[model samples]
Target: MIDAEEKIVQMADLEIDPAQIAAYIALLAEEIEASVDKEPGVLMLHAVSVKGSPAKIRILEVYAGRAAYEAHLKTPHFLKYKLATANMVKSLDLVALDPIAMCSK
Candidate 1:
């Protein structure tokens, strides 16, 4: 069971180059899969795009805590994704959150 108050949740808002959206999505998928499969601290990683703007992406990330999030940043898969997508990304905004309630079945 996860303690909602102890979790570190955040939203990653990114603007990917229109021409590179496909490539960016591929990398993002791979990274999310690897993180959840390999790290117990990684609670969730869900990525979605706006209704009509495919280049505008948002990722909802949930980690066990600050240390878990920090550890994720140093993982090989995350590092690879960051380096590979550096040129494809136009802008990125990271928003931290304090959850009042969180649940999943």
Candidate 2:
């Protein structure tokens, strides 16, 4: 297990059409929740959207560290998600953050 002192944050901004954004988010969340347990060092996954921006999606993913985050990106589930959602996403912005604290012990 990773030390609680180490944490990582991943933020994603996705641009999608308003009509399909809700369905896309629901599907993505289900996929994330289903796949997270298999991902090593993943602490939690939180997905959100702006109140006024139905087309925008924001994700906050917490991992054990940089290595964990990298591994997560390479997972089959993530790859599948990327491929499946390619058409739904118009643009994406991903940011990696340094961790100050973690929920995992």
Candidate 3:
């Protein structure tokens, strides 16, 4: 059965150089999407950028619960992405969110 309980999630806002935006987007579109789908308890994974500010990327990830979210950080793809983009990213802001309500019925 699907878990309907509230979940804690992490949102990451990343700012990159304009020149590297295209490459970052292409890399994520080709690799990250499929990789994240394989993770357990990952309810949703999304990546978006601000209009006209291609260098700004925001990722919203929701997990089944705290354990699931923690597990995701240990995944290979997450580590790889962190390493690969370390130099490309100019700034990163991460926030933890507490979900109060969710309607998926």
What total of clashing residue pairs does each candidate reach? 0, 0, 0
RMSD (Cα, Å) for all candidates, in order, is 1.0, 2.8, 2.5
Q: What range of 10 consecutive residues in model 2 has the weakest lDDT sum?
A: 96-105
Tens-digit per-residue lDDT, 10-102, candidate 1: 999999999999999999999999999999999999999999999999999999998999999999999999999999999999999887767
Clashing pairs in 1: none
Off by over 4 Å in 2: 1-6, 99-105
Q: On residues 7-59, what C-alpha lDDT tens digit does candidate 3 reach at each position?
A: 65778899997888777777667546755668767887778998988888898
CA-lDDT, candidates in order: 0.95, 0.78, 0.76
Residue pairs with colliding backbones in model 3 are none
Most TM-score-accurate candidate: 1
> How close to the true structure is residue 25 of candidate 3, measured as C-alpha lDDT?
79
Candidate 2 C-alpha error for residue 8, in Å: 2.5
Q: Which stretches of candidate 1 lie over 4 Å from their true place?
A: none
Of candidate 3, the 10-residue stretch with the lowest lDDT total is: 1-10
